[model samples]
Target: MRTNTGRLSTRRLWALSAAVLAGVGGAFASVTTGETKATTRADHFLQARAAPTTAMPPTATASVTTESPATTAGRPVVSPVLPFNAKLTSSDIPVRGGGVRSGACSGSLIAPEWIITAGHCFHDINGAWVGGKPRYHMTVTVGKLKDGDPGGHTAQVVDVRQSPVNDLAVAKLSTAIDDVVPLTLPDKAPEVGQRLRFAGWGSTSATVVAPSDHLKRGEFSVAKIAPTTLEALPVVPRTVENSPCADDSGSPYFVSGDNRTGNLVAIENSGPPCPQPGREIIARVDILTDWIRTQTGDTAR
Candidate 1:
């Protein structure tokens, strides 16, 4: 779908393309409620889009860099281009083809076995999402920089949890990830206009073109919209620009300001093309501290 700015909305574009998986007899189903319920075959399908009437605060800060023209092009493209040989490890997520699969999104290590990622990344074919339970098939891989293939270390996802209403998700690995040090979450919210860094193995460029299989990274500055403006637009927190594209949906948005600390503030939710003019809203993890603690049974604060 095209946005007011004339660019294709990545989130909507991916959702529509993903529907093809269902057409091939995949068990994909749209989720309506937050609670788990019985699954049934869908008679029709509605592409996921930005829900209207949701409110957001204006001028919030992000921990990444701003977008550039070159980075916004269609196709799988990496930005602030990293060295071709730069070594980085990524978690591996396998999904069933045809319909949306139950595989959760790949994430980066934040602690010994803790990985950070977007909450929406975890899902099943029917979209009846599940988390905070050991039953979820969450997994983490390290020492590999390529997508799909786990280069070095791999571990089973032991537990998955998220903050209520926040886009952040943390997964505990069954075993410790050696060699790679864990990234840290920000203790405080980012200031307005803070530059941030984002990395993932999802589609490198927009979804209009073919998705990329190689790991891609980009930089995006946080753009905050007035809560009134957000409410007026009736924008859902999940659907906003400067967010993740199709496959990058579950990647984490990390801090890249003067503070060298790699604190996480947002997870890719939805958005238009890279660096598009619009408020890229993320589920504010800082605001949902208590809920996160309750779900994980950990004293995060």
Candidate 2:
């Protein structure tokens, strides 16, 4: 099944008519007397049954500037241009024909053998949660700014752990990736109007739904800081030119005070189409810091 933006992968076009796993309702499903049943809304990338009334925000215009020979500047350039290689986080889900899915969301290395991603990414084809033998297989690729880049570390998931309340999950890798430095988890939650960076291998165009094999990064201004989530507005071209889109679930959001160092702040959960005017909900890492430490055996307090 194809969407207006573009053709969707077979793995992505699932029916909501069938019984599916749990998901967050855009506007928390309301309940009334004698009716406790709540309907679920498809998380990010899932085709929307309801057409969005609001159109996406207009792309901002800016004067392009050149960067030093060593460092590139302005907007999230596609991979190999301004490689986000230092952090070592990347989009991990593989697609058919033996390649990583474009716009397949993202995850970060919290430890040499552990990756943190959005909980929704862990669900099965039917959108049902799975364990032990996951209905779907997942592979984590590190040190790869572009999908075709060589010498990167790739590991299959050996185990998975998901949160009970929020949309967060930890995956244990079959092998350790020691060369790439793991990202540091922040101890505090982000505040409103703060600048943050989010990168992924998702779709880059505002209207297109296809994913680019190259890594792309973008900046966002935090608008709301909830206990478990943060809603942000895209500030692309500042650090990136793209917004997260289909298969961009499980992407990492970072808080970089020094602009060189990043602290894992949240996991990309759901949002409207890329470059669209909608709340990009990110799963806050600070609230789940303790849980993450416990799950990954990172006991540092």
How many residue pairs clash in each candidate at the backbone level? 20, 12
Please report, as a residue range, the 10-residue window in candidate 2 with the lowest summed lDDT. Answer: 30-39
Tens-digit lDDT string for candidate 1 (1-301): 1111123222221111223323523222222322212111111011222222233222231111122212123422222222111111222222233321122243566665566665555544453334655433444544445544423455666677743333356666666643444455556655566665665544334434222355555556655532110100112232223234444544556664432235665555444344343434443445444444455454655
Residue-wise C-alpha lDDT for candidate 2, range 1-301, written one tens digit per residue: 0113343332221112111115533212211212111111123333332243243222221111222222225322222322223221223232323332212446777788888776655554454444444433455665667666544555667787876446667788777766555678888778898887777765555455444577777788898775466777887532224666655666778866554346888877665444546667777788678878898888867
Candidate 1, position 51, lDDT = 24
What is the alpha-carbon lDDT for the whole of candidate 2?
A: 0.55
Name the runs in model 2 displaced over 4 angstroms. 1-103, 205-210, 236-241, 257-261
Q: For each candidate, what TM-score against the reference?
A: 0.53, 0.66
The candidate that achieves the highest TM-score relative to the unseen native structure: 2
